[model samples]
Target: MSRHQRLLALLVPAILLWPPLREAAEASMFRHMLVVFPALLAAGWFVAGALNARAQAAFARWNGMGLPGLLYVTVVLTIWMIPNALDLATVNWDVDVAKTASLFSAGMVLALSLRQASPVLQTFFVGNWVTMTIFVGVLFQALPTRLCNAYLVGDQVRTGIGMIVLAAAVGSVWAYGIWRRWRASAVVDDGTGVQSS
Candidate 1:
């Protein structure tokens, strides 16, 4: 396999395992959503890719919009995540951390979707996705029964589920980036080969 494929293989398992581990500390409902969300997002992307050439073209255009688009997404996500972080202080520490991470991940998706679509934005999305994955893994490792105990205060399940959704969002972006890179490389190879011949 190529380096990119290898990287993708590593990333896929990490993203897939994140929510179930984290959800162990929360409710079953949350766990369900975590699994469902990524599946749904993947399905959506597949449908769009198959049915809407315009959307694919739009993503390409957005990706090429350069610095202005990146700046816009960064600023917007930062502004959105700040209040969510502040809200964290009012909740239980663990709950707050999970929620805050979800908020950040969601903000990234929204920001990137609104801006010019690009593979780079996909990279940012994947970074946030990996972060949530790590957070879930850590929570499970640190507090396994915490998820099972219904008596625990705060919205652990909801937050966990949100992270899963966020991961799916990130996965969609990552897939887009991979597709874009492959297309670009193919074009370059074709042009160079034609010129040399």
Candidate 2:
């Protein structure tokens, strides 16, 4: 990363963790999940770039094929997606800290694992995550009452819509990349009589 990029990465988690900003993010379920959680994860990803070679090697050794890291991320995401988990995090300082820490770790692990993971593994994990997101979004919208005690019915509905849109966008991009790669591979170089990856 460039110097400026590294500085910005360092600032992100710090700014997000600041008392006022943290409170603002947590005050609404929409911001809490969609904004704060993602921000923390992103912050972790950025921070991972700064890790020393030894640390990276260790992580790679422990997270063979990225499966373990991906699984950890999935588990953390699943937990925080629960309505009870959200409510507890909002009301309890302990849960809130756990939420922040785990999400951040998940981001770092995701960055490292994704680099090591094969295309098939990446697709499996990402596809499952996207599908789960859509399912949760639909549940949020279809429920008559608010799922999270910390958020209102309207907020829940809005968040649901946002989640669905986000999932669709991610899925679309992933699919497009896959399609482009496949299309490229299908082309044969006449001179070499070989396929391009």
Write candidate 1's Cα lDDT for 6-70 as tens digits.
Answer: 23433332343365543453244344334433433333323332424576466556656434444
41-126 per-residue lDDT for model 2 (tens digits): 99889888878789999889999999999999999999999999999988887788788889988988999999899989999999
The lDDT per prediction is 0.45, 0.87
The positional error of residue 23 in candidate 1, measured at the CA in angstroms, is 18
Q: How well does model 1 score by local distance difference test? A: 0.45
Clashing pairs in 1: 25-147, 26-147, 62-116, 62-117, 63-117, 63-118
C-alpha RMSD for every candidate: 12.3, 2.1
Q: Which residue segments of model 2 deviate by more than 4 Å?
A: 188-197
Estimated TM-score for each candidate: 0.34, 0.91
